[model samples]
Target: MSGDVRLEARGAAEETFVDTVHDLLDVLFERGSVGDDDQMLFRLAVSEVATNIVEHAQSREPIEIDFALTCDAEQLCAVFTDNADPALIDLENVGMPDADAESGRGLAIALAALDELTRRTEDGNTWILRRRRQPAA
Candidate 1:
């Protein structure tokens, strides 16, 4: 709950809900002083995580979504949690989905955009994303 910026929402896991999640990231990047390039990459990585939850969570009731984005001297870190079913997604083994596949690419995109990306089953499902910050010009 405590971070440089924290965004929390409780709602149904539907595709239409992802834009609201993106708006949360926009707030974090703006207030937390993230630059344009870093903001773009962070947005993509976080969006993928949220999209995966919406499409796969299969929650009958509203699911809780939590996001924490922090910036330090070295890296930007994000932690996202959703009250969804425990899903075993192996980042190492999950290859790029086919070009024509509509789904199955979220994890891959997150993995590519993040310096460190990991998923675990905690109080539901949690995804941690970290990216090293480039030295200032």
Candidate 2:
């Protein structure tokens, strides 16, 4: 996609965001903007991040969030901006938990599928995830 596909919501459930990501990726796929492998990886990372935000962000009221995705020949990117408490985890040190663990795998999974995953909290919490596209053979 030349521009970005955007969604803005307040206190949306994880499923909503995840579904939106899938739908957006479908559009990109139909447009020949990304390959199947890229779409699958980006969907996985976005779903994990959306679930993490909905489950972990502490807020007495509904959290407002802006989610956007973009794709080009070289890469795909997703950005999430939330009006919730700053996420306090170390993005650089996100590690997968033990296999038996039920939680704590979201960030790790996202990191593995992404070339760049970062979080900033200057004006609310902003998360950016990027994955480089593979060369077409």
Candidate 3:
């Protein structure tokens, strides 16, 4: 579980977000490490991040997503990357805006769903998401 899958897209708009997530999920499913719930959560989290890039990342720059699934006797890890500017997002302040708000909940949900979430901007914003896969019975 120390392999990586690298995907790149130029001018990927919101219309292609679902396809990206599906592609990632298909890879994970093919590896036989992702279960039903894990698949759902992965799709949800990836979509949220991808949508954020499409909506707020300013330029329609090329997006690079690197999914690294690593497993030992403990857990699984997924890392995503995009070339969009990261300064626009305030990760520390992710919260529900209000009960009637239509947006602003995706990031919070993603935070809660993933066991570990980390974001950093070097050349571009990179998000690392980790979750513990269930042990074989």
* TM-score for each of the candidates: 0.81, 0.86, 0.73
Worst 10 residues of 3 by lDDT: 1-10
Q: What is each predicted model's overall lDDT from 0 to 1?
A: 0.75, 0.78, 0.63
Clashing pairs in 1: none
Candidate achieving higher TM-score, 1 or 3: 1
Error of 2 at 126 (Å): 0.5
- Give the winner by lDDT: 1 or 2: 2
Clash pairs of candidate 2? none
Model 2 alpha-carbon miss at residue 105, Å: 0.9
Model 1, total clashes = 0
12-78, model 3: which lDDT tens digit per residue?
Answer: 4455664765675576656655567766775677667666656666545565544444434355566
Question: Which window of 10 residues has the lowest lDDT sum in candidate 1?
Answer: 1-10
**Distance from true location, Cα of 47 in model 3, Å:** 2.0
Q: What is the C-alpha RMSD of each candidate to the true structure, in Å?
A: 3.3, 2.5, 3.6
Residue 59 of model 3: what lDDT? 45
Which candidate leads in TM-score? 2
